[model samples]
Target: MSTSVLQWNLFLLVSSRKEFFYMDIELPASLKLTLSIVNSIPIIISMFGFLGNGKVIHLLGFHIEKNPFTTCTLNLSIADFGVFTSFLHTIGYIDQVDTIVYIYLLVTYFFLFMYNTGQYLLTAISMERCVSVIFPLWHRCHRPPHFSTLVCATIWITSFLLTVICIIIVIFRVTTKPLFYLLLMNAILCLPLMTVSTLVLFIKVCFRSQQRNKGKALTAILLALLFFLFLAFPFTFYVSYCYYFPHLHSLMLIGFGCSSVNSSINPIIYFLVGRRGRKSPSRVSMRAAISRVFKDVGDCTEDKKSRTESKVMI
Candidate 1:
């Protein structure tokens, strides 16, 4: 859709040229009040997420041994921060006197990029865990230096490029059909892979006796992925609704907020798991949590590798 088409749509939506997307969105007084109260959460959560993830990343880099897993996590933190910053922009625009639809489009795609990046990283994390366990010898011997880093770079670049394309789509005002197909492609490409990988990881964690009682790392991953799925499900649902039931389009504030909360809550989950079953104060608390999660699972893998005929890398 071109600017002219959007302008026409805008004109059709409201006689006053200034009114944009949300102006026509019907909301009950109760819903409005709910939104007003709930709207304040993302910023606070985003702020805390940024600081907490920063601390975790710092600890990982300087104190903990770098690995494929840690590298993916570092990228996850960066992506979460990107989502946070995008939320900040979105809230800034939505709270304004006159919200420009174009700003919304840009911020929406930014959020999409961050969200998609996280999805890929989640898939990578699961596959990495699976690979490490299933192919310990080959993984220890054959995996190349900086290979994981390259994979992370590819994930980031792919997501960023798709985001740019999305932005271009909106900025150029492409037609409704193209928009639907783009979103449909996302539904097809991203969500199913996420579900399958999560399921596979969960199975590997649960049914494999060797993995049982291994540190709580898998437990933590399962929890984060489940909680994130609960919160993030609505956005995918909404995308389909937009394509199939266009006339029924409604921006459910609570659902959108929950999706943002997925990113905001991750650092906290990492902190909790890192510090799980411990009691300590401020600075001392974070002192070694980074090493613990990595090392707990490390001991389990080490025990298994102890019996292997092939030599393993340190």
Candidate 2:
């Protein structure tokens, strides 16, 4: 039967790969060419990603004043930069998959580590905004000054550890179970938290609040979160699924391209949102525009305290 023939071919294919993690299944010439082209696009996109996120990093890391939201933004930019740089490995290996398969696998997981960290930071940013909006007075008065710094540090360390474990498992030919569960856990934890928190912020700021200045920082957060959900989440979910079911690994190129765009677009989102309401087309500098975004959000939170103190004095 045709089914029996297909089973035999599958068995022979797996047997020859030797390295289970490599999963070197054969591809048609046209399909290979398509994947090669797809993979090359991310390499090109990484240039723009580097420039955009680099400016963000330079601005937030040095020039901008330290605040909780700015702390998260700085870390997210670093993670985005990491993802962009990791794509550089694809430069020489687009058509050939024989010799550097192990290196390829390591770089792939590294990309995941960087991207997962971004997702965690995004969730944190959203939740912080939501809480500040929902409980403005308490958040303003009692929230710890170093909270965002602590959270971002923890996320980077944890993601790095998990990624090391994943690479080790892949190297040693252990079961792929850990990779699947890690991805699954990220999906379970990050996706829902980001969704709910974003929704809360949107409803409260856009519809319920009477305030005229809802803050461009929050607008930037909403745009970044939506981009991740639509553009990046698909690749995350797909790669996780493919790890469990190796036959579906052919779409890796397409997924990376999608995620590359997601990583590349955040800087533009910040610039556009930050530039809102500015009448002068050429007067606003990048630093000025970005400063307004974070400054406006800080003002929103601190304005109540200032007003209260003035009332008491009066």
Candidate 3:
């Protein structure tokens, strides 16, 4: 009887352990499915918009006068797609997920890296606009479309290389301390560049008050900087904490979720704030103005016909 009781207790313990492992696996799969659905919606919407407009061509093919806003939207869409796809492959399919995750991780990281570079590219576009507005002669002479294209290409290439290096580092399972150090270095570098771009924009606004449009431009750039700061800081903090305390791995995972929110927030910011037009003509007012112009033209033609009839009567 004593042996039977001991055997029963061991069996229960083993069953409980298996149940716990299964629960752990299922919970993450559920979460990943939820997250993928949420992330995928915006990506799908953006893709539809990109295709509905002619923006898809500019993104996939080379064009001399590539629309900057469309290009930015494309980059954002691609990044979100990568994030969603990676999450699905890595988190949703856990049993055979490792190899898929590795590949998807590289894909996701490449998109993120490119998105960051695209942010800088946007800053460059904004600065170019400001310079063109303020110094038309100089901008006309120096800012060639081909040069801009080359710069964008270089930015994409460099970003891809950097991301590849990071992926390699991750694959090798580099020490946490080194990863933390690397993240810190990147954050440090990004901060100064973001700050300088912000400061330059501010000075342009303050000194070039003649160009009253600077306010909107300044606000857009500042919003981009804020998005970067918000997205990056939590991830950096989590990484630092993980480096110091290995037991807080769960917190690091949560922090990663917070960081991922940045990918979604960025395009939202651009769509909402960056796309606003000048206040002079509201949509309604613009339509009314067009109607009035057509009405006046009709009236003028009628008047001319009536005068011609009167002259013929005379």
The per-model lDDT (C-alpha) reads 0.63, 0.73, 0.47
Specify the highest-TM-score model's number: 2
For candidate 1, what is the TM-score?
0.74
Candidate 3, 217-259: lDDT as tens digits: 3455556566656664576666567556755556555555554
- Model 1 worst lDDT run, 10 consecutive residues: 1-10
Give Cα distance to truth, residue 27, candidate 2, Å: 9.5
User: How do the candidates rank by TM-score, highest first?
Assistant: 2, 1, 3
Tens-digit lDDT track for model 2 on 261-306?
A: 9999988988887777878846878888888888866675467558
What residue runs in model 2 are displaced by over 4 Å at the alpha carbon? 1-36, 93-97, 208-210, 243-250, 300-314
List candidate 1 segments past 4 Å from native: 1-36, 61-63, 95-101, 177-180, 207-214, 246-251, 277-284, 296-314
Estimate the TM-score of every prediction.
0.74, 0.82, 0.55
Model 3, global lDDT:
0.47
Per-residue lDDT tens digits for candidate 1, residues 1-314, read 11112222332333223334556444366644654565566667767767876777687777777666678878887887777777666555443424465555556566678888887787677666667656767776667757779999999998888767755554455543433465567667766765765786687777766644354566566766777677876666664564454444343344456666787676666656667666562443664655666675556445545745354443
